[model samples]
Target chain A: MATGVTATAGTTRGRSRLRAALRVTAAVFGAYAFAWGIAAFGSALGALAGLAPAEAVTAASLLALLVLPVAALWAFAVPRAVMGWVLLGGGGALMTGVACAVRMALP
Target chain B: MSRVGGPNRGTPRKGKLISPALRAAMLWPHTWAGVTLGGLLMLVFFMGSLAVFAQEIDRWMMPATRVEAAGVPISLDHLSLDRAVRPVVERLAAGRAVRDWYVQLPEPRRPVMALRVRTDQGNAGGMATVDGTLLPPVGTLGASSFFYPLHYSLHLRAGFVGYWIVSFASVAMLVGLISGVIIHARIFKDFFTFRSWGQVRRSLLDLHNLTGVLVLPFHLMITVTGIVIILPIVLPAGVQTLYGGDIDRFYTDALGGYERPRTGIPAPLAPLDPMVAEARRLWGGGEPAVIFVHNAGDAASYVRINRDTGDRISLDVEPVYFDGVTGALLQHRRPGPMVATHRVLSGLHFAAFEHWPLRWLYFLFGLSGCVLIGTGMLHWMEKRRVAHGVRPGVGWRTVAAATCGTTTGLLIATLAMMLANRLLPAAVPSRELVEVAVFFLSWIGAGLHAGVRTVGNPPWSGQCTAVAGLAAACVLLNWITTGEHPVRALAGGDWAILGVDGVLALTALASWRVARRLAHRPMRMVAPTNAEVSDHA
Candidate 1:
């Protein structure tokens, strides 16, 4: 009975550790992806709004830098790790896709 | 910024901006990021601080460059660049055909003109006095080539891996800073709080918070600007979307740089003085700082002159390109508004202006960053010691070793390298590499010592003593070898040596005092109870 209890405890500890690792991974890379999406979308949108390509890129990049830290901090503030991942990582992908589409649609 | 009711479920505490759960969550990234990357941050900050005086340090190390006329800026109008400078470039090319060459004009801080030539054989560089007499190679990479590059690149050039790592740490630092401010309940109160006579833990926390809150703006500005300087390289999403990911093309467009392919037909280059005069005229009177002759000895050669940026807060030189044969203005390009804004931001970080007070503030604020990171790690170690009881765990020991290695160990390595520069034979082949090797080897040695001795407090006092002694030795050796003692240096008007030696002396004194204090008060570990020990077993 004691052995079984200890084994369960060990498994629980391992699971929590794995969850923590996943959260950290999401916080770092997911936030990075989100920032990338911001940069891409902002630049493409700026270009479509008749700004020069270089100007749009510079302005977008500056804005992206501001977004990165907040996104990273927000990743941890969210209650569920999976929610953070889905929102950051998934939102990043969707935005990046839209950016690429917009670029393709450009004259 | 405060979130309202959520799944946190914690009782709302009075006067707290953030929920307890949010604060706790922020603490994880803050603590872990500081622990893991604090060593690298310390290195970057310290190296950057040193890089602020890179030119001065270069003068200290390369004594041959301690020109008596250092403070006097050489006039481009008075010097015949084609007559005096061209022969030096030709000599550097030797029998090989000249590809291209550039000359960095003598400034007040650096009295010698630095010339670099790219020949068909390879590349060669030598310094010349204001009168264009070629001096022998300084032989050492010195601060500009080594420490300044190490600040941003970590000397890792292959695939920009160093830049990526540094940028990642910078982002982590930004995260740490913002999260830190969010979590700190009384940042304003903490700004005025430093209880140095209190317990080490409290004092470390106080110092950490004090430095963090005090220089927070500088830390943020420096980090953001540093990142902005290399944004295209680190985050290429915007570049990829707009410019098809061609960083070179992006820079050419963004910075208004001009270049053209070289023609094989040989052509005699026109006088560079005319080009400098034309560039200055085009800029409505600005000093020509660097003159670049591209495609040398070719029909397609063009001369580009960059205006001095010392008087302004923009890194833009307002480069004016001239035809090599005709010396006629080819392209005088100016950056657009957004690019100009980027240059201004970059200039803030570069701090290449002539304000000594601002330069010293940059240095001090930079060192404050080091103090912040150092105290943060110290606070962590102390906090963990209280929790973990008498004997430190493996995790604690590792952090302790790294803290020692990056803090005092870094100082030891830098001082030892400077000492090596003084002691190494002047004619030693690859003396620069030897100095660098000394730096790395000493750093490794210090790390190993810390690792081995981490079982008992990580040898902080001993390492401090070593730093004190090594720094003193460096100053002494410089005097003994170069015959330029601080007093003599001042008398002879060599402010560079005087400044370097004076800092070294101060370092020695401060380190010695710290060593004594640390030795007197060894870190106290909480004693584990017998019951607790058995419970662990």
Candidate 2:
């Protein structure tokens, strides 16, 4: 009876640890995606403007697209990815904020 | 008593593997999380899938309008801005209380110059020839305009409820997808394997998993983009904190300056033809889709040109402001780095710039997502039958009915609504309301039929019949109402309408085949197994 109780207790502890690890991974991935999206948008803009280093800007945009799925998959495995996810989400929020600001400031 | 004669005599059973308390905790989260949000997710996927062909549907439904591209080069030479400005202003001010006015020039597919004026009471717009004679108000509810908006915003009471519902569904979908992947670690190995003739449960599981795995990338992209699409609404608290709670101000800065109305006194204006010609010089001869005139009949009046080329998503032509009287080019508003990025993202999400080929691909992907959601629901019901240790009860039955009704019934309802469009009187009061009523009524009728008639029978055959019937009706109705058979329409170069009918006929044929197969199948009565359990879970 004592052994059975100990075994159940050990399983519960292991699950709790796994849950914590996943949460942390999600945060890190969210942050990475957020930064990547902003950078990608900037590069795309540079490509449009016919500015210096145009080729590099185009390359960066393509890279961002390729990496997005990988980062999302990583978020599923590690809790740290959550940070990156949150960061990307936060960036989207910022862009939206800027849009709203521009709308109001205009005549 | 002999052990052979006991109740457990012939059984080779193991003891319970999981404690009751632990099982309850684990199962509670899975059941409530899935059941609570499953219906809403189904609605989002189904509507979004339909929205993939929104533009094509628009072309099919509004067949009365005709546009012939005039390859006339826009020239500023001998143009008079005076004639165009004075009349539009006088007409707009005289007709109704104005909120905003938009003017669009002739393009390849839409040759008539269009003016959209939103009034205090409701939205009203008109298209006219170059000479300014008004055309009849176009009928037929543009599924692209109505359904696309409703897909994301649900077109509910002011779109608030719809947005909230979609946001919640997105979050739930994210959770479900994550848990589902973790549960099925061997997802890739069996990616291409599908056995249609397996045990009932295994087949169901296979369908759910196959659809989910095959369209996994599309599902993720759509879900993430959907959240990104409404980032502002979801995180308004942060914006309010940073921007002093003035939402409009924030938008103006983000989107660049709003076109401010000119304070200068009114003056005689030049003809619009000259300004259009000037715009063409800058935009390289592409037909302008929209022409925004700022400060009409004033010294500061500016005309912004938006081209309608099929390749580029963004209207990249610079806004060319002109003097109303002099027709001299004024300041141009060029797009900066950030603005261009915003436009590209918007274009991708809306599929605004896609050709027919890419649009069809989007349609297929969207339909696959819908199938994924529908099969997910079916898998849930199958899982519950095994887990509950009881015969499928009223709750399971209700979900089954709803699943059949909402997924297949929605397709049926759409066809019925299209049929109603042709048969109903054009001048009937509240035509939109009547059309909506027909749509809902048909859907409700389908649900009631499925619930009563297919309680014990396999639901797939009934659903297949319903979908096939509606699709067949759609084809027939198109022929009867339009007075053009598919072959005749195709030969006459009316491809859009004919294509719509052909697609519906093909869908009908496919559904009929599925129904026939279901009817002939011998092993249709067995309960589902664990493999299928994981498909839905």
Candidate 3:
């Protein structure tokens, strides 16, 4: 309801221009943090799953590298820039936490 | 809006799901990103496609290399390896250190045996026949060393700034591609949409979208893999953290974990035949392409034998090692999973380990990527061309000229380099430098021509005509200079030259067709009416 109201408050062009700028800014951070976090989480998960450390690190890094474009898509497709960033941060944190917990618990 | 609201009909009403506002929001970034970096991406894709045939281009450039390649069997008995290694030894003896030199033996892939010497003085070496007879200087840096570097380094004027620029453009392309998909209402259904004879801007937009979607996955993978390959230089944190900042150690680990130390003791180098025999024996069957003697003539000298690629999809050429003094084998272990994965990703980007069929496929897809960028740029410029009042503003005019310069100008520049290669005397000092100069100079000329050409009279068709003529001239000059034109090259079973010339002829024909289309377009750029404005919107 608030999104609809704020969206209607301003002129269409002005609101959209501001939103577009924010989207691009948020996306750059989302892409970087997501890329780094995914690699870390992947390696942790792989190590816990009994894969060789080198193999796990490599496979995880490579697969995570592919998520950059999709992450960009997610940034744009969301209803707002803040929501997109929140999702990126939340997902990255969860993955990193799970990966860390798995390493600590198993070892 | 003609083909909307079907696939996007999820959240109750169409407006609720993907509102008109959302579509416009996506379009803003998509258009800007795609337009701004489109030209550079076209260059990257175009040169990258050409680089796939780098070895083939080397053979075409140096016609003497056509008969023997690095892959074919050659008699090492008459190879006279000592004579080839003498110059580097002499250079080192003179006190100025010889940087690096290796015996690139004659094989079917790169037939001539090149001593490939590099000292502080520069390339003071030449190619040799199988019997060690000196072949004349090959003149031009094969498109591999010259034109192909443009793909990554773009001339090194600012020292690898080109690579970083390309990397950034690729990221923009990634973001733009994703936004394009989000904004697009019909993706799979509009896969085959190309209305060539329809209203001009509509036709171009449709064509751009079609090519963008057609090779979408390939473009994505290629862009991603390119970024991955450059990550070492771009984001060094991974290596810094992992290896504790020792790059050399990281390389050693990646290369199956072996590094030899040089001991200063005068010793005669062992004959390479025994090491070659041992490597062949160990590997079942494969010819050695490179015979690298490290710390040559030193007590700690070791020889590494690298196998040429054949019928494999890997960039990791497992090297076989041997003691240079004793000719006894010294083995290295296979690569770890991390290294192996890196090699595969790089191999996919380089596309080196493939036969001609796969190379052609990569080339075709790469050209399609160029088309996607070119068509997208045209769509944007076409709208601006019509929307303008009197003569259009400076911004629109600059973009108009830039569009022609990058598209047709790049073609002109590439062909001009090949022409310089043929015409420039090999004995002329810095012959390769002259050829590269011709390349950049011609590109500048094309840009100037496009900039001065009047509005409403686009410079495309004229520039394209020049491109066609220059391309045809390149084919002809090869015959005049080398006596190895496409017809005779084909007759002599020299497919390398044949393929190069054949592609040039086809490009000429295609350019001419483009020119003809541009020549026939009406004076005024077609104005999009209120009805069709929604199409772009």
Best by lDDT: 1
Interface RMSD of each: 8.0, 15.9, 7.5
lDDT, candidates in the order shown: 0.86, 0.58, 0.71
Best by TM-score: 1
lDDT winner between candidates 1 and 3: 1
Per-prediction DockQ scores? 0.42, 0.05, 0.22
TM-score-sorted candidate list, best first: 1, 3, 2
Better of 1 and 3 by TM-score: 1
TM-score of chain B of 1: 0.95
TM-score of each: 0.95, 0.71, 0.85
Pairs with steric clashes in candidate 1: none
Rank candidates by DockQ, best first: 1, 3, 2
Q: Which of 1 and 3 is the better model by DockQ?
A: 1
Error of 2 at B7 (Å): 37
Q: What value does DockQ give for candidate 1?
A: 0.42
Docking quality of model 3: it rates as incorrect
TM-score (0 to 1) of chain B for each candidate = 0.95, 0.79, 0.88
